[model samples]
Target: MVIKKVSIIGLGALGILFGHQLAKKMPRADLRIIADQNRIQRYQQNGVFCNGECCDFNYVTPEEPCEPADLLIMAVKFNGLKDAIQSVQKHVGENTIILSLLNGITSEEIIGEIYGMDKILYSVAQGMDAVKVGNQLTYDHMGMICFGESETGLISERVNVVTEFFEQMEVPYKVDSDMLTRLWGKFMLNVGVNQTVAVFESNYGEVQQEGPARSKMISAMKEVISLSEKAGVQLTEEDLDYWLGVLGTLSPDGKPSMAQDVEAKRISEVELFSGTVVKLGKRFGVPTPINQELYHRIKLIENRYTMIG
Candidate 1:
């Protein structure tokens, strides 16, 4: 089906970055922002400041009536995913295509269960060094989106429709036939950089430095690589090297999504990253001691937040 109307959920870094770009291409009215009432007010008042420029797009709260979108992009954090899904239920027509840019391997599963398997697509955003502070967004890299079918990893007509939309918007994206491998590859990157950054409260550059932190990051990623092979995903040592290279190229002072969450005193996606690794490791009979340690450390940090509240 041709995609004319697109709705982006969440106003986080990726959401705002992609939303602004899409607004530039599509009619501003054709692109919608589905966020909470507070976030809606914030955007309505201040607009979205992206890359030193401000752009305002149409927005609606979940309580308001929204026309079913042709495509819905899920960009909320893992913790907020359940509510986000429910909020956008009214906007999901029979043919609405769902693409989740949230990190983790299981977001597609969760979205599929709610929206039906056929409507869900596998996706990940990469190469972005963006950060969101309040209503303002700043980024050094624009990033590319990779997506495809979940079951066969083959490009379907729906996939092509989304690709054509991106092409028309001049948005950088790839339609991967092996989207599962790509997701697992990105999963490994998140397990390495995101968890370690949150635990140590460090940035990408610190993790890249030759030190114990870097060693911990590599060890955690190796655990993911081992688990991926056992799960029949064919992740290799070379894949690990490639992720390491990607990590090396990130902005020195840039913080990952998890680190940003920790700093903002918001809940991090430890459950998505380290939690998934630990669960999968148990199922696959693979040891994930490093991930376990990182998971517990992040939980303790989160628990502190709970206590403060």
Candidate 2:
């Protein structure tokens, strides 16, 4: 599959980070940054800066007439996904491969349902510590993205094209055979780190400290592992320990995306993390007490923001 045209559907931190990298290698004409009018104006005025470089990619919105893209990347938050899907309809052709970097287990499912299942691919981004302040994106840790087919787990032609795309753009990525397992692994990480940081209103260093917050983080992660096993994903104790090791390696001052959203007074992705866990727990007959508690606590904080509005 020859991937000529590529479109990214969000201009958030991860979107800008990857878009900037892609713009460095790919022709400006081949890439399109999909955003709304306000964001388009912001980008038009300020541009997307990452690591001190400016992105020069074309920007478009749903109101504009555009051709379908060969590859479409969805980088929006979970709560924004439904509207994001509708916004990208004109950019998805029959052969367009949709890859989502959202932090959740069900994003691909939602995309597959709207766009045909065969067109959607499973993917997740990890190790990124990029922070967005206004239109500026700064980060020292550029993450690697993992993606592949959900069912066959085979290296298809499209998968090879995606890998080649990342390589050509000098972006780090991995093609996994068991993409579902990888997605669930990332889901567990988000459930533990993202929710804990948001609920405590702390950073990674604080979560690593010895306290009730750390205990709650571990308990929530363990519950996710149990639920994954019941769902037949085979996530084990070792995987949980591996994630803990990964967390330890992160920058002490680094804050998860949820924590950043909370600080900005914007809605976070709690629904994708603890909310999803609680929903799946009931389906699998597994008790997710830790996740339920975290979900309610985060909701209370979010409610205060809503009340102020």
Candidate 3:
């Protein structure tokens, strides 16, 4: 299907970056931003500003969220994915291509139950940073995002449309035969960064810069590597370096969506990242002591946040 109008059903940092980029590239293409009461009003009041390499996006969210569209890109946190999907699915159509842009190993399969895999496209996003200072968000280090449907042997016309959109927006993206590999790779990266930071109570640089902290980070990554092997995906040493390179470029103060949740005294995605590794390890009869401990520690912090609230 040739996609024109699109609705981004989340107003998080990722959602904003995605909606803005889509609208910027195809202005004639209808792009709507759907946010919950969370930060909907503030977003609707400002629009995304793609000012060079800076997070100067003054994006104003649309007051009226469109009732679905030909394309629906979901950038919401996967922990609350059920609610997020339920909220937007009613507005979406059978023809709408759903893009699960959330970080986690479960997104595509979970969404598959709700909307068949045929209707859902595998997607991954990189090189974007977002921080919400109150109602406003700042972002930079704009990177590439990619998505496409695997139509068996049949050539996909939708893949070309998505690639064309990326070309215009200058978002470095690609469509590979094993998008599943890319998804698992991204999940492993999150398991390394988000899981480690939450467990250590530190930022990206602080965690990577310190000795013991860096060791913990590597141990956590190794656990993921083990799980990847059992799950039939081999993550090489060079792969570890590539992901770390992305973190190296991050600003010391720049935080992840999971970290933001921790700061706001809310539950985080430990279960989605490290928690996922530990679970898979159990299934494969592999030991994941470090990942298991980190998962529990972070969950304790997040649970406390929920309890006190």
List TM-score per model, in order. Answer: 0.95, 0.95, 0.84
Winner by lDDT between candidate 3 and candidate 1: 1
Candidate 1 TM-score, C-alpha based: 0.95
Residues 96-168 of candidate 3 have per-residue lDDT tens digits of: 7778889977788888888788777788886566676444567666666756664433337767776766676
Provide the clashing-pair count of each candidate structure. 0, 0, 11
lDDT of 1: 0.89
Worst 10 residues of 2 by lDDT: 242-251
Every candidate's lDDT: 0.89, 0.87, 0.70
Residue-wise lDDT of candidate 2 within 116-206, one digit each (tens)? 9899878989887777877788887887888999975598888898998888888899999899888888889889999898888888888
Residues 1-309 of candidate 1: C-alpha lDDT, one tens digit per residue: 799989989888998899999988888888989878887787788778998788778888888777899999999888889999899988899999999999988889998898898898899899888888887888887879999997654778999999998999988998888888889999999998998888888898889899988989999999999999888898999888877887777788898989998998888888888899999999999999999999999999999998998
Lowest lDDT sum, 10 consecutive residues, model 1, at 148-157
The TM-score ranking, best first, is 2, 1, 3
What's the lDDT for residue 120 in model 2?
A: 80
On lDDT, the leading prediction is 1
Clashing pairs in 1: none
